[model samples]
Target: MVSTIGRSFNFQPCFLFNSKTVDKSLTARGHSWLWPTAAGVGATAPDRQIRAAAEQRPTWLPGLDPPTYLDGTLAGDYGFDPLGLGEDPESLKWYVQAELVHARFAMLGVLGILVTDLLRVAGISKIPVWFEAGAVKYELANTGTLVIVQLLLMGFAETKRYMDFINPGSQAKDGSFFGLEASLEGLEPGYPGGPLLNPLGLARDIKSAHDWKLKEIKNGRLAMVAILGIFIQASVTHVGPIDNLVEHLSNPWHKTIIQTLASSSS
Candidate 1:
């Protein structure tokens, strides 16, 4: 009876072997009657399943998966790391802080450039152009002394920020510089929260703070692009961005960016 059953069913004693061994044997022998699911009957290991899941995951760019390190926790994260710079966790942390700083500066720079140009055009102030202001000769004596003082102040602040980044929450809050308290306690590493920083209580909670950060990063990115374009336009046309805009509005067909570049090259 046993011999008849074995001969009729083609039973090869699969119970004696492990699942992986059975799978390998069946696959080697061109047999796939074991597993009949969508995952298929061959090579359904945990790593392969993980890889499939990653492939199915979507990113900012369609049909592409985000990098493994960038799991969409940070604000403004769109998986746009083409150069793979943020592969290491430590380096990525530092880079995130640095990018925030640069973005903030770029936002401020765009505002300053636009306001300076607008004030000049409206005859409110006769200040030099934003790019050329450094070369302007001021009437104040010892301008070099003022520059040195400004540098010292800015350097001190930057050093403090850098130290905070390196050793988080290590700076003392009891110290004062020239009657001004140099305290950044009870805040995030980069954000020095106080009335001066958040007078309107815009970021009252964690969720609100995260939303505000997203908004800030988006606007900061736009401002960075705007400032870069402004620099290029100023260098090419030797005019402020506001003036360029006026020219374009005055004559849309002939005063376009391409035409301006062509005329400048000519």
Candidate 2:
């Protein structure tokens, strides 16, 4: 009887060792065999299948694979090409540059609007409302000539930028005219870094440059949204964003966007 007990104990330990080895192998393959109950089995199959599936899942949209083009090379790319606009490589490059340009413009626009409104609020009566600035009467006698000259200058600059984008490194950087270089040697497509751009050397290294690019894209996106909101608010209320904020602050209950719209409709 003592001999039989010793054999049984040895067999039990060997069986447990094999079971543990099998569990480890399964776990390594993204599976579990610990739970053997009916409910556990029902849950395990789906979970295990998902784990066994391809790893390249979409970040924004669940259960879908990310686009082939969105390999996370761009600064702010999150595989967000729902419309498949950037499927083509060349088109994707152009869109990336275009987005950067638009974002910069949007940031500038939001800054201008907010600053103008804040100045007006601070009793700067000379500063006209941003939306109404176009309609404000100018004191200049030759306004048409000024507009024409401005348009010509802006058109020339924009055309040069566009041509450079189409054929990068084509623009001369001899800096012959007033220390002006149309394109820099080591800058990105839209970013024509010269003595005037980022002169502080904020992005000195590769990692810092990438970090700055990410920050710029994020802030630019937020600025674009803010500018859109400002336009919508201006169109709806016929007032500046700061005025709207002041009204809301003064009377939170009734000065809200929804309440204002309801009252206007009523």
Candidate 3:
């Protein structure tokens, strides 16, 4: 149980997935240029202006197209079975796949803000005492967030379900259910390093209770509490495709990922 439960959490297409997904994502790399970090200058407006200016240069290679990353990953994976083929497929396959996952992973760092809030509210575990004292600790926490974002963007997941890695089970399985609870306990140990609790499952558990009305009516304290908890968690969490400038600049992990994959293509 790592004290930094929420520490390295990120949300990217490939971060939660395995190698196949990573392979697909890398194929979309186009631009290899990186904007070097500048000090003292504002990071927003001038950054945008610089980017716009760079875009006009006809010699510059284009950045990865979103549609390409989205569709490319799928097409490359489906068309060429990298996992089954092993290292037989062209090295370019692995290269593109890695970059794809990396870029998507970088964009997923938006989740860090909420994870930080969660720790501040109710952190799951405590850090080791070796570095728990004052200045070291705060810096460590901030550094952890950056590391988490970096690792996530770099797209190397230790735990990925064969089923979900191939098939994302966003909804409740078994058809009769719209949540994943009955299967929570059965989760492979050490999987994803997260508690298998399902908020949606909790809501579904008491559906038949008191003819559903009483359950949904919020009369029961248990249900009310569960509902409130889910609300607070969701309200604080922002889950969606990343679409912003601040998010793009802070993504150092992805920049390196693309570079590695793009280099492979050559």
Candidate 4:
């Protein structure tokens, strides 16, 4: 009975997992041996030692199951586990649709602004200068509003995506701002990870979560650059100070250079 109990307590009291040592030393030890430490003397079995160590873990740690390190070694600090978050596919679908709508709206708004600018700049047809300026300003204002909406939508999408990553099982209720009900079964671990208890399955899910983050980073870069460019163009074209500065840039040397070239050609 003592030997059986000692075998159950078989654990290595170390920060790093060393399977060879743990199995050879802790597992092989019986109740006849005892673990002596600052905590106190206890059964040489790994399980009792692990419990003692876990009881000493800092209370400030966040998340559930502060104990249970992936490796056989005891965890000195809290570890990340995406499975802690319960499954909910509806929230994921809402975010996907929200981002899609924002992307489409942003594309249309930018195209409208660009088309208006092209008509004025190309001078393809006679139109009053004031009318063209007004049209451009109007489009700029509308586009700016759309851009702000896109920014907000992107922020929301990013936040939701992050939450989803941290907790794969999360779900949103029907009729939320994100959209109607939808399933996010793909995000769930059972599909990609295979089984809950398998280490290989857990690793796959973790890797997939990281991949999603990478995709978001790329999308964020593109959206930021496009929005920044739009704002810069609007400022350069419409701001009175910038426009006046460009109009007033003059150099007498330009005329002199042209005249000198003309004389030489003659």
Candidate 5:
């Protein structure tokens, strides 16, 4: 699984950012490159499209292309502020080694399992035949994803706290860990004033006990999401007919590969 993540899945940094026609691309660059927040680098074909789109925008930002910013921060920083310079070499290196790799492995393991699973879900592959693991499929996948989900939540919670500690403040009473603050916090503040104040103080005010609990809760939520995705992907991956025609392919996971392709091979 670790090997697959290392060789197959490429982790792409993601920021939950969007834009209208209002401002420069400033903060967008740095919005999501945190440890656990790294989404897949993105689909290769789509990445090319994204790059093409950014190229049409402005080079006001340098090093925003593939060969340079392997993590795609340049595109994130483009049209924005001082530009998403990312971090110093040391930190950047750690981000890749520590965060990116972990995320990559966890996410890919879930994905690989799901890829193998899709065949059975869509009626393309049926039980009472070869490659059918029966109910065991669901059980094993659920068990595996449960671990991933747990680890994911743990990863996110630790990541959030680590970022919080390294950063300078509270996350606000509202509870938007990502900083949407009032708009996104779970428990609303007692009064309207909570909306405008810097959350760092409130974040700092949290006791160590509560903080640990909060971390656990956040991680638990992420674990739930990962489990859900794994479930869906598991079913979806097996919903194909390719598994029946494995003799035509050359890859080790032939059934999975053929099923993933858009069309049949000769």
Candidate 6:
């Protein structure tokens, strides 16, 4: 009777050795067989939903087109025009170049100071070996001061430019809380100091600006971070506490790179 039952069922001793009939039998059980399929669908659904949400995410500040840089060129075309002393499209290109130059000089000045401090701590007094310690110190001090001033100026100018761009039609309306429409309770959309100053619009612009800044940092400014990282690493290795906060604030990849290079060379 057992042999007849076995013959009727085509049973395999191990799951690994199960035949098509067993699989078919399992599928015939319905809910139990569908569990894994359901689980897989459930697992993938969230990811698909997330992607769809990202795709559908609305962008504010719709009309602004921020300049992009590639290979030290504005939109991969224009060259150096640091003073913005050009005409039309050239003026726009020069603005980008000037911004880049300003950033570069600022980074250079900061790195120079940090590196010099590191060198001094390491008993390497002067960089050239010919210049007096006093002279090198004086040079660095003056240069750092000048660069810092330039950086501050550039920052102020850039902020003004950005503010103008974001609130082109009416700066007073968009940025300030207490604008002309703020007094009017019945002000409608598309009017100056009306919907522009409303919570939703302000939130959208703020979010857009935040995203734009993030994109700028992620894309064009990595080299600045990396160059600054070298200074941080040098300070950490030799000078100690001075760059500790900077090292902590900066990404771990820089530290990893510095350590790996040190190890490989040693």
Most lDDT-accurate candidate: 1
lDDT of 2 by residue, 1-266 (tens): 00111111211112334454555565556554453323334246675454334244334444343464676667886667656777788888888888888899999999999998999988976688899887666878466777898899989867877877887766645652344664243365676665467576556454448778989999999998999999988888888998999999999987898997887678
- For all candidates in order, the CA lDDT equals 0.71, 0.68, 0.35, 0.42, 0.42, 0.42
For lDDT, candidate 2 versus 5, the one ahead is 2
Task: For model 5, give the RMSD to the true fold.
Answer: 20.7
Query: Mind giving the per-residue lDDT tens digits that candidate 1 earns over 1-266?
Result: 00111112222223445665554566567665564423434445774575576556545655455666776678887666766778778888888888888889999999999999999977899977898988777788467977998899999988878887888665544553342333233266666654656566566464447778889888988888898999898999998988888889999998898898898899
Stretches of model 4 off by over 4 angstroms after superposition: 1-88, 125-225, 236-266
lDDT of 4: 0.42
For residues 1-266, write the lDDT of model 3, one tens digit per residue: 00112221222232344544434433346321221223212236675565454345322124311211122222222122223333333554444444444433333332343344344434453432211222353643686687688778544332233234344452225542334335553222212211455434343433233343222222332333443443443343332112112243577666443563464558
From the highest lDDT down, the ranking of the candidates is: 1, 2, 4, 6, 5, 3
User: Which runs of model 5 end up more than 4 angstroms from their true locations?
Assistant: 1-94, 97-156, 159-266
- Tell me the tens digit of each residue's lDDT in model 4 across 126-218: 333322444453434686786788899989856755555566545344543345224332334222222332334333454445454335434
- Candidate 6 per-residue lDDT, tens place, 77-140, comes to 2222233233255455445545554555556655665676567546776353211333454544
Cα lDDT of model 5 by residue, 1-266, tens digit: 01111222235543366534424343356533332322223234675676566456444334333223333332122232232233355454444334333444455554554555465544665443223443355544676787788899989856654554344344443454665556433221111123344344354333333453334334543544675655554355543233333433555564454464444323
Instruction: Give the range of the ten consecutive residues with the poorest summed lDDT in model 1.
Output: 1-10
Question: Poorest 10 consecutive residues of model 4 by lDDT?
Answer: 1-10
Q: Against the hidden reference, what TM-scores do the models get?
A: 0.76, 0.73, 0.19, 0.26, 0.21, 0.25
- Cα RMSD, model 3: 23.8
Regarding TM-score, does 3 or 4 come out ahead? Answer: 4
Error of 3 at 2 (Å): 38
Error of 5 at 182 (Å): 38
Sort every candidate by TM-score, greatest first: 1, 2, 4, 6, 5, 3
Q: Residue 234's C-alpha lDDT in candidate 1?
A: 91
Best by TM-score: 1
